[model samples]
Target: MSRMSTPAESLTRPDGSPIRVLVVDDEQTLADLLASALRYEGWEVTTAGTGRAAVRLAQELTPDVIVLDIMLPDFDGMEVMHRIHGHQPNVPVLFLTAKDAVEDRVAGLTAGGDDYVTKPFSLEEVVARLRALLRRSGASAEKPANVLEVGDLRMDEDSHEVWRGEDEIHLTATEFELLRYLMRNPRRVLSKPQILDRVWNYDFGGQANIVELYISYLRRKIDKGREPMIHTMRGVGYVLKPAVAQ
Candidate 1:
């Protein structure tokens, strides 16, 4: 019920062994605890105290999954994820942060994070979420036609096409990326800065309205003449769901 419909799970290789993982946190103790828990779950684990070290370690280790902290030294954790993703696109990221705000969660998700957990969380919960993230990440992503259906709207990853019933929708590169990101997440609210960081670039420099502007553009093309599929959650961010006929 919680899992999204992305093909990320099928991307797993048949190693039939523990998946290697990297954990990055400024707080070394928390990092160690998480690493220990992951190791207990039969996953090989590595730890990084700084973002630069995390990137270098990720490059060297080629871990299957990453447990990344949003706050870091050397570079932003978002940038670290981006750099690591460039080397390994399929690796899933589970974000660890002290910021428990809805907007922060939105930012992480939009930044391509598979999951998030606020600080002072249980070791068991962290382990469980990391496993789920890995499973989702392992899912196959080869075919863009592996469409993720949220409601009435369907997005084709293979063809980069979106459809609302009989209507064929065209999207710009950025729009498609935005939609794809939202689709990958299903019901999660995504923030503008996070959207900028992940969909645009890790070092993205732009106004927050870039997200609002693109949202307007997308709604015009994808939601016009139909019930609203995308919604604004007030001070939080944006979430995409099925269009409910009122």
Candidate 2:
């Protein structure tokens, strides 16, 4: 007898709606199976068996995340991704491919895929990747407070305004949320896994370098010409605290 997989507990939106996901694959059985697993995670799942259908459904469904197969029946997966992006530019995409070559992965990422998984992958890994993508893109269900402050940096969640000392700093929504997470836990050493879980809301199975990338972005905007408050604990994690006197 086949083992039955249990659905993992997941977070829901403020309105209690499940996160939306679009699964695209030329193989009908694969698409349905993937959709079933996603639905098991308590997400709203839509499936498309062709690239053109995927693009059309993406527009109509406006899913929070998309799982796209690199190979398609009617059109190239990349072209489908482009078409869908034309309508919903910020929707996160995870490419599914049978090709495991570096070039294929690089091509998919270069074409604006947020992440990807090679074929013959476990369903649990796919779900985790989707969760991380949603978290990084601010598509997660949990919403923070209206304002957050740490040191001289202030972020007004309502107006989406950020200020460092006397100057106002502009940040993208993702950056703002990352900063808020850091500010919320001042002086605490947060490892990459911890940051991924708390800030991105996923247990990432890939590289942790994304954390470093966002940290550098925050430093340039928040620490430039000021006492640096974001500190790296070397092989541990990161800490945010007040800078000391010179």
Best prediction by TM-score: 2
Report the poorest 10 consecutive residues by lDDT, candidate 1: 1-10
* Per-candidate total of colliding backbone pairs: 13, 0
lDDT of 2 by residue, 1-246 (tens): 122277656856446788999999988888888888887788899998898788889878888889999998889889998999888877888899999776777577657677778888888778877876775566775544467777777776545578887899865445666787887788788889988777656554555766787788789988988889999999999998877632
Residues 1-246 of candidate 1: C-alpha lDDT, one tens digit per residue: 022222223233345655788999988877777776666665678999998999899989888778899999778889998888787766778888888666776687566566677886777666666655544343223334487777778877765567888788866445667788888887788887777676644322345655786788789988888888889988888988878642
Q: What TM-score against the true fold does each predicted structure earn? A: 0.55, 0.65
Mark the regions of model 1 whose C-alpha exceeds 4 Å error after superposition. 1-13, 139-246
Q: How well does candidate 1 match the true structure in TM-score terms?
A: 0.55
Tell me the deviation in Å of residue 185 in model 2: 9.6
Q: What's model 2's TM-score?
A: 0.65
> If candidate 2 were superposed on the true structure by all CA atoms, what would the RMSD be?
5.0
